[model samples]
Target: MNNLKGPVRVVGTGLIGASIGLALGRLGVTVHLVDADAESALMAERIGAGSRDVAGEPQVVVVAVPPDHVGAVIAAQLAATTSAIVTDTGSVKSKPLVDAGALTDDLSRYVGSHPMAGSERSGPLAGRADLFDGATWAITPHEGNRPEAVELIRELAETCGARTVELSVQDHDLAVARVSHLPHLMSALAAGTLVDAPASHLELSGQGVRDVTRIAGGDPRLWTQIVAANAPALTTLLERIRGDLDRMLIALGKDDGSGDITNLLMNGVTGAVRVPGKHGAPHTDDATVLVNIPDRPGQLAKLFADAAASGANVEDLRIDHSPGLAIGQVELAVKPASVDQLVKVLTERGWVVHR
Candidate 1:
């Protein structure tokens, strides 16, 4: 990996920016934190992300501001820095490229990149050094960008511990619209239905609903800016979904015993299975085994130890807590071939195990 140049200035010390600082700090690179909000910058500095008082001009300036303000900041940073490569962490790339291009004739030093990793949490306090570890970072370099500058930005991403995928500005926008923005909108729409839901309905909530609604808990203000920035691409996706929804409604309205609804559901199953699993491998039909565990310390540890002892590598797991109960159900996903031995070991160990 090419070593990152000294004094990388990070603007807008929010979650993404601060995380970059922390990740770069792990590489022993000098990071200068800057934010419009003094408190945010100060908090980020206090957490050892970087110092706000770093001297000397920056070799690279990262604009991690909200989507709406990305272009103007990129333009400003490009104008302010003599030779520093300007890169952004914005989700949408085309808008910023256009926005920055409008303000300046040359975008040679400007590259757009997006880190495909984050929590629902925001702000500097929510930042961490390992945020980008093993995560995908998309780099969208416009035609006008210098090759060396683009390569430096790629090095910066690697230094932050993320793998890089290069795409065109328009291509990056379209890709994120399908993978990120569209899904966020779907999650929000599904979560919206539960706003006025009765307590009885909520009482029946389980891991499935929680999983679907998890990303919906993000800041709405941030999402509004993001979706609006990529309106063209996102609108295209939403229209396709609208067609499916109309078909679903038509199927529901008919009692003709047609298989339209079942086919639509089957389409979802097909797409779900095509989704990449851990380490970007093809999805697998891992067998899940549920174990009733006592709600006490060391119970989970013991379950894990027993599962390890069974010689079945636990692939994935989810814990579903029963309301007002002293027990939790752990759903463990393991290979089908290992399920029998896993179950036998757990059952022999006196665990309340079930398929």
Candidate 2:
């Protein structure tokens, strides 16, 4: 399971597919890249991800196309070869299996998987060899799926530096609706709020607003298909969010009885704390140390070097630039045990440290 053997055919040349190829190829696995767009396949090949030519029988076939196209493409791949095990990286799972009915009835060799990693970018150009490092890659296999085939799929995920998890197709879909699809819809909705705003208001916006709406910049065409394909699950989640918004609105209309607003805000505080922190573990409230950094090329690097010199591991970092000043505030999150030492180290290194 450590190294993938034999030829692996990838039926898409986008970020996930190309990244899989790059990870496998680097480990000396033979990878064959394919895409409906010939140029995309060629581009992935040119990037040393894999070759366009697939000669012999493949040991594995990865279908990494759009959500709606997954079932059809997986069916086609199954029709093309009965020897290889097939898997897909689509977000939705149950719908595709239902769509692929007969093709998946003998689902011994087919599995559905999704890697919990990606930027709001696509195509071969955005592929990274380490895209899946330490990321959870969920695998959903039918009750009758062959164990060996599932093992091979897990091996493929591990080869790409991803942790493997097994989940039912239904559970997988529901989990993603809460954690992924709902977030995307919310981000898009938040970003849409700015569509008609005055230019001056947008100009004054800072990183916090940008962070909330970052995923809104994804390809609309792709996202539309994704949202539509998973509409049932997404709609349910959206309705719950709508209910919360309704409560907040009603609270705003109340006179002298707006305790509901505080309750709603407290609910958000509770929910936000439930989110997993660094390395997918329970959240820990780390100490924040803010330092004023000069607007210079190597200032950030120097700050990190100083922190390392003090042996204080920086758990997380964020930066905010002054509107009209030649400086930025670098916020560093460190363990409580290391905060005092880090502040002392930075102060000695001529950094204006703020706790």
Candidate 3:
């Protein structure tokens, strides 16, 4: 695709918008960050996300607001940037598309997009330049959508290192309801159960519990808006999962290992294993080491340098930190065979190895 000359306007400086700005900026594309809150727009720009103000008409406009506000925001943005092609990163597309269509006659330049990538964080500060790397971005084009507009959005996703998957609006909602929305609801419910339990109960939690409830920490206001917007599809998917869960409970009550409940659980495990990795290949089970590093300048660089010097290819990394902590735990995922070598390397470099 040929590089467009005009600036790209991102109309919300949340995590998704800021990330898009960062990716576009890195591609030498001028980006204008526009948010209702001037502070948020300024913050995004300060973090190298984009320019602070909306310049003349942008070539492309991305609306990245909360679900509840996305439709109104997109309409406003479309009106403001009369000549620009518009798209959105809202989780639910049909509602916003319908709203935009009903509210305006200039629907030709609008396409709906949802990038299947995020962390349990919000706002510009939580934005990462590599957030969209190797993720799938869903493009939902309606009858009124211009081919050029859709292609431009696809190009944007490609530039940010995301694979483009075209889906009908209905299909996109259904798929995300099953894979994304349902899981968020489940995580929230699972975490809610522990609210009344004693604090000591948390100490006994294992990785399984942690993994299941991890997304529960996401912004509740944001999720509330999303779930409400996509309630129909999300509720439908949740009912299916609830039915399966009921069957499992009944099977356990009957003490019957021969029931179909085992198959249901096995299907979930198999489905999870089918999710592709960064290189678009199935992920393999691997071991990981947790290294505790002091929260000081250049500590992470030192650890990574030491790991490379010792000939360890870190497969993945997760950092756990808290406010004002002197140290943070870094979980380094690696090949099972390489764990020993990695530990040896870190220990030799005078770093604390937590296993």
TM-scores vs. true structure, each candidate: 0.94, 0.94, 0.78
Error of 1 at 328 (Å): 3.1
Question: What root-mean-square deviation over C-alphas does model 3 reach?
Answer: 4.9
Window of ten residues with lowest summed lDDT in model 2: 100-109
In model 2, which regions exceed 4 Å deviation? 102-104
Task: State each candidate's clash count.
Answer: 0, 0, 0
Report model 1's TM-score to 2 decimal places: 0.94
Q: Worst 10-residue stretch by lDDT in candidate 3?
A: 277-286
Candidate RMSDs in order:
1.9, 1.8, 4.9
* Model 1: residues with Cα > 4 Å off, grouped in runs: 323-325
After the best TM-score superposition of candidate 3, give how far the Cα of residue 211 lies from its true spot, in angstroms: 1.3
CA lDDT, every prediction? 0.91, 0.88, 0.85
Write the residue-wise lDDT of candidate 3 on 1-355 in tens digits.
8645548888899899999989887788899898999999989999999888654889998999878788887888888877788899999988898777678877788889999898877889988888998889999988888788888999988887789999998899888887778889999999999999886777677667888998898888888888888888987887887898888877777856555777887888998888765466566666778888888899999999998887888888888764445878889887788888889988998988866
What tens digits encode model 2's per-residue C-alpha lDDT throughout 280-346? 7555678889999999999989999999999999988889876778989999999899998999999
What lDDT is obtained when candidate 2 is compared to the true structure? 0.88
